[model samples]
Target: MNDVKPRPAGLRAVPSAVWALGFVSLLMDVSSEIIHALLPIYLVSGLGASMLTVGLIEGIAEATASITKVFSGALSDWMGKRKWLAVLGYGLAACTKPIFPLAGSVGWLVAARFIDRIGKGIRGAPRDALIADVTPPHLRGASFGLRQSLDTVGAFLGPALAVALMWLTVDNFRAVFWVAVIPAFLAVAVLVFAVAEPARAEPTRKARWPLSVAELKRLGPAYWQIVAIGFVFSLARFSEAFLILRAQAVGLTPMLVPLVLVLMNAAYALSAYPAGALSDRFDRLTVLKTGFALLVAADLVLAFTNGIEGVIAGVALWGLHMGFTQGLLAALVADAAPTELRGTAFGMFNLLTGVALLVASVLAGDLWERIGSRGTFLAGAALTVVALAALAATKAAGPGDGGSAEAASTKEP
Candidate 1:
């Protein structure tokens, strides 16, 4: 611990490329969240879709992206390039932006969502890998946090913009979607021109076959532990669409519903960087435990309370958990996996979590239909208890054990 510097450098001390990547994420999130904030309402109220249908759509879209990430991440490692694949992903997402406004039917929305998520799938692993590639190992948590915080800044901004646009356009969903297309393309432009990929410490040209059993085996048990944790955490946390529904059930207006997201993301953006920096200085697992504790609190609050204020409190806690854990987990992945296979490791992690999310969302939707909103949240709290136990057990097993990434990290302050 004495080997490292005591004080952390400011954001300006990080590489310019990391800043550029953060902005790229920020703009794209601004575009995506603007559409996403209102999508459930649009499908249910405007298109007469069921809550189960909304759950299934959200689940399927994310699963598709998660599944696609494995291939893209592996391909980046195999091809010895991350930027081109990332550019392709952002461009594909930009192309799909116009489809949101043009859609008149459920099928159209589904297809457009599928395509847009494909773009996310393509870019996600590579972009994450690029962040790892560009930053110093010690600063990875902070780098990932900075990028996530910036992305969340867009997350809040997008919903806030949607609220404003809905008021101005008199509830025109299509127009807001139309406006979303601009920033997505702008994100692509910045990535292509502004960010520079750092030279890899090790050459990847020798390994063209990234999916071989030998290649897969190269990712040790430590990496797999991270994947398992991600899946369990994902199960306890389902689609945010349900949060919006809960708010509406509490009598929040259609336009004002987005404020829930704005508030949640505001908490997320505010805490992410500090949490990431904290992980770099402290035991990462201890920080993650705090996140798990917050989720449990959030679910219990949402389950027991019927008021909008309770929902507000729950959503804020949910965002704080997200802020505290997401970037730290990304840093853990970078720490455990071999540098050459970093992209593949992230893809696998996202893949398991993505599948878990689909299951969780579908189950939440079913539970909502069978019981009530309270039942749904209560179920979440129950699952969260299970996850918390698993996390504690993992922590007990020690850092060098398969379950803990602590052995892999460098927390020297």
Candidate 2:
């Protein structure tokens, strides 16, 4: 027998639905990153806030999304519909964009950020579930990778655009924010008209009481294991604001700070598709471990080094870690959950991770305040070690699981 194996189908073979979703994500990220790349500086430099305030705001905003995802994911499962909820989420986010440019006080910014994150919460789980639904199992990794890559393209573009616009407007932050609104609405429009819900999995049970104990129990041990892995992983990751702060600390000007995100996201976009495709063919857990190693390496580099070269290398490593793990985690949830419970599973996982992230960011800020920047990253490195240990012995990292192309559509039966 010939030992050579054929490669799987390429991006052209991916569904139109997946591509549409990717664009939706791409547009929304473009809108979100443009603001996010500048939001921390705006809050601190312009609004006279502190790093702790930035961390608190970021944590709370993200935690709110995690809280809402629990309900939104359940709701999507109950309705057996993902697209409409995602549309509503995107629409809600679009409506919040104008507020960023108009806010005069911290309270206004906080309110807008809260609502915007709520929109993210609403769509996050359902959207992930929808991707799993539409694509065959064999293509789930590639599908997710493509979506992440597109989303990351937007991520980089938003910051790169912000850099250009900030210079044009003479560092007019509000103008850049106003421009961000256009892409957000475009995201909503694409989602509304272009994306369609796939057929629901066969009705295995009555739709009532999706959150009931019986239904919750159906989420399975494997899914919970993945959730645990995600939670610990969150502890290792914090707000991107710290990356910008690190860049600024090393003497990068405000107008050029967005370039940090541009660099980070560029690495992310370039790596995500290849990583996702690799996960589809290789052991996802092994790939996840590799991502963990990269994250640890990033933290160590940032912790021990200084200046532009260090920041660039560290941020690029951070992006690489994201490309390696994020989609794999999504695919893990898809593979582990029962088809009917995917939305719920993703929501629950995010909820845990969200809470962990909040705590981690707050801790990071505190560490930065009391000790120094090095302390913050060193702490992150410590947490990454813990997370790596958790994954090595846990149910999440099974032997050669979800490694083959045949495993893409292989949900928990």
Candidate 3:
């Protein structure tokens, strides 16, 4: 008889800290999505920006966050601390919330966006590392999945709220933006009050200059492999703003533009946990492969279909792919990196991938401008094929590969 019985299944098994952090993410996402859902149209129609400029801005904002993550993550390692850094990051972001409603020009909006992302950069790695710190190895996938699912819930909820507010305000973007600020602050409050850092068994040892070559070398080849694959995946995916632009191109009204994200996020939120839990049980790489294939399917759908219904189908697929891929990648990083260097590993991974996203978004904008939305999405499909090929080639290289889930866990959970 097996006297040890089993741990609680699903969410009950995850630590309280992970749940609190997920709520923090959910609140912040709700705040951010409300603004983001409307921002592309606001920049184009209200502030007189062009498609290339929109792409440039979005790319730069994300890149800034990724770049900042490197320093912030390294700092967290050097200090042997995670929670306070996360708190500071969330606070900074919350402070930037009001600026969106107050901005009168593109420059103001850009400045606000840049600062806001810096805050995200500051928090992103530390928070992720914290999740790894608290979660048991056996439950890593489920923990990440639950957090992602909750965060995505806010992702859709925010846009749904934005659509409702848009109807009520008669399409006042500023009013909707003002409303977004509340959740940003609430997210900060939750992080500060509800989440607590886990106690380590050993005394905290600081990594001297965590960004140094020696320190990076400690992250090992497995981590680097994940980073490379992540970069390729980013190139194939690009920014979500393009989805809104595509909807608009196909005659979606400004008032209903946010519905695009609402639909996409609904798919993402629904699938993220199930996909993650499934990965924990089966092979993660295989699930990720299916996700890559889904992206390919999504891009092809968007490329060929001219009707709104087709665009809707493509966007939903896009969301589903996100669900299957994003959290799994994070869990892989936690699986690959040294516990002490998890922050730097996540930061470096994000840095490379964020650069790829910049390149992809700018290229997508240029293609859309020159050849239309169809050409842009067709190009995306082509890139996804290349990424999928790269992934398959890696798997073909044999067992003990950097991304092999089986390699990481030799025993049953």
Number of the top candidate by lDDT? Answer: 2
Angstrom error at residue 158, model 2? 0.4
Candidates in order, TM-scores: namely 0.93, 0.94, 0.94
On the 0 to 100 scale, the lDDT of residue 228 in model 1 is 84
- Collision count of model 1: 0
User: Candidate 1 — worst ten consecutive residues by lDDT sum?
Assistant: 396-405
Off by over 4 Å in 3: 1-4, 203-206, 395-413
Give the per-residue lDDT digits (tens) of candidate 2, residues 68-91: 898899899888898888988999
Candidate 2's TM-score = 0.94
Spell out the clash pairs found in candidate 1: none
Task: Write one digit per residue (lDDT tens) for candidate 3, span 223-316.
Answer: 7777888888898888899999999989999989899999999999898888888877777778888989999999999988888999999999
lDDT tens digits by residue: candidate 1, 183-242: 999999999999877776555324447677776666767677777888888987899999
The Cα local distance difference test for each model comes to 0.85, 0.87, 0.86
